[model samples]
Target: MSESYEKFEGLIPGDGHPRWGQSYYYNAYDPVRCLGVFIRLGFLENQGEANSWVIVFRNGSPLFTRTNLNLPHTLARPADGVEIAGMRIHAEVPLKRTRITFSSPDCSFDLVWSELHPLADCIAMTQDKDGAFAREVAHIHLEGTSTVTGSITHRGEMAALDGKGFRDIAAGPRNWDALLHYRLAWPVFDNGMAFCGIRGISTAGGSAYMRMMHDGEAWRRVTAIEDRLTFSPDGLAVEHAHWVFTDELGRRHEMTARPLFGWLFPFDTFVLREHMMEYRLADGTIGYGLHETGYRLPWQGMAD
Candidate 1:
């Protein structure tokens, strides 16, 4: 079957409403350690401001919260004092051909969208002393507007921002109307340490899909897996799967994916899920990184 791109309506509760948007990133190292960061950006219908904040999480829990700062920015680690931002940020997502120029007394930079694709978005810009880094952005578009305003309250923390907007979509309280986007890098060990790009999608109907770069190959749709999913007591989950991919060459490649870690988020309408799977050839050889899942997207301007 061809790759399915079915449209979903109200997949997210308050998509396209006037409110701040939040993006999160989580990184998991080989053995048994992981770190995550949550970013909140204010968005209005026709206005833009400098109100953005980021929260860090480690080992499936909260670590620290940084307010009024640029995202993917370096932060000091409390454990070893070693810089982890370099590994934490994979890529930057853009806001659909949008550009933002920021100027301060000591520094200034321009955020421009250099690439736009159906799977991921890239925003390119230069920071204070750093040369250039593209910010990869992703989000779950909601369906409606909110009634509250000023300082978004998420996970019991009050975020102060420069705009008047309500809860475009409820962030907490475990509602199901939410969408998710996950990005990660896959290292292909068999072919001279070659790496492939992988992404996942999660939607409302409990349906998910994974897209990845297949050794300079085109996008392929995975049909099924050979294993079951395992859940942890703390809500962490993992699984190993064998996927059957049909590529553009009209050939099928059977690859085994050993999941290193999984990230789970509770949504309003559905439970969002993502897993970092290590792809390997059927003969027990490492191939690439496979990030897979799906999410519901808010539907707008649709005719019945």
Candidate 2:
């Protein structure tokens, strides 16, 4: 189905369910070698303050250990001229009993908790409609006695974390199930291109909605729930799907999404899911994006 499309005007109120207070994103890839990395940091308002964290999946496995503690709010821009907002965190992996550190001027941070799972594998793939790109799978066997540290900058915050020993098993699904409601749209690369999408359920009753931007210029909102879904799992040897977004403004956009890889943590009863998507405009120009989700629901408890 085709509709009149316009440039998305960034994130708007009442767009989709905002997952956190404000969302930050970064996606970089090497198209020639088919390798890429995608990262996202989400902030949520707790009481009168904002509590935020970072979620990154390198290749397909959880890149950094998950932490529930809130990092100190600070801003740091290193020599690279990258600005990050957040806190510096240090974590110890119980499994390998290793330490890692994450320091950055951006909004996110990274550290190696365990050398058991290393970031070495590189997958093959193409760019997305929004310029987002990534590898199909990362087969980096990070197992050993080692120390690694890295930092990420996003959403106007900076933070860092460091620790050693990989205590947690790197393989398995981590269940993250929570009902989220928010809207988001960001214009990067000098606003020459942009993309926006939303997924939320009503607070009162059975109201739910999802929408996306087509060319970083047009706004397409999906009104009918039944008409906003598309499933395709046979393209890249992985489960694939796309959703149709139609905004309240009568705009339309098509979003094609696929899982980069899946992670299941049987011990902790959690699942870490990562997906790469491509948004194609009516004119056929493409945009790329990465989505990382955590599912923790009642069904998970039953299985446990």
Candidate 3:
């Protein structure tokens, strides 16, 4: 029932929804250059700001990590593109492709993402409150695929971006702290697939809304979900997780994940932890993606 909402590629979460948020995000790894990029632009309507961050990783470790506490929400141009405070993400080919440019005193990058696979859908699982909040959170993950190219410059050294990447545009009214858990994984598998849902790893109550995309189509829109997550005592990572999703067709599929690395973002209200992981399927193929856990975790000593 979640996916009945139509899919669109242009700027979304327009002028309504007072609590709305829209995120334009991308992640890619360049094996030859041993560089990786993960950037996110969070447009929050209520706050009238775009809280964005950029993490540039080199040789498996972070080279640069920076965040913009608040960029004006006016930067979210859903039609042609967005340009805000030295960062610009404009369309190169409309629905199927885009070019992103980011410049700052420390480093800069210009990249293009060209679509290779079609779009997929996934719902964000939250409480069944029978209200607009549930409707807003339930609509998440308009996913896509692309090959990235261009250049990344840091500390006088430069590297070309010739990598495969996954992208998603998430839009909705969000009371982020109220969300306890959701898992977004896109293990870099040759199978050309991705999955997002909620199953294990929640102390507070929440429901399930799992969905999977395979080879540019809806592989499964889940009707039932089961998951188990084991987090480290420090709450910095989800060390292991297993999920079984039952599709609307009543067939079940399983997937397992283990972490490669993770980061924790502490806020005044909650802690957000996300890990990059390697996942294995029943067929023995492996892929890489993120395991993100939201809301408060058992972390003891981080400042807001």
Q: Pick the candidate with the highest lDDT.
A: 3
Residue-pair clashes per candidate: 31, 96, 3
Q: Report lDDT (CA) for all predictions.
A: 0.31, 0.30, 0.64
Predicted model with the maximum TM-score: 3
State the displacement of the C-alpha of residue 98, model 3, in Å, after optimal TM-score superposition: 1.7
The true-versus-predicted C-alpha distance at residue 216 of model 2, in Å, is 4.9
Can you give the TM-score per candidate against the true fold?
0.36, 0.39, 0.80
Q: Rank the candidates by lDDT, best first.
A: 3, 1, 2
Q: What TM-score should be assigned to candidate 3?
A: 0.80
lDDT of 3 at 263: 68
For candidate 2, what is the TM-score? Answer: 0.39
The best-first sequence of candidates by TM-score reads: 3, 2, 1
Q: Would you give me the overall lDDT of model 1?
A: 0.31
Q: lDDT per residue, candidate 1, 187-268, as tens digits?
A: 3444432222323323332223222323433223333322233333433343555445444346555655665545444332
Q: Candidate 3, residues 1-304: lDDT per residue as tens digits?
A: 2333233335565547676777777777665666777777777767778776777777657777777766677644534677766778776565467788888877899988887665455543323334333454535556666788999898888888787777777667755555555555665565765565544223345444445545335445666667777877765567898877766567676889987666666554666676666678789876666667765544342221
Across residues 57-166, which tens digit of lDDT does each residue of candidate 2 receive?
A: 44445444343324332222111112233333222322222222234443344444333222210111111212111111111111112233344444554333232211
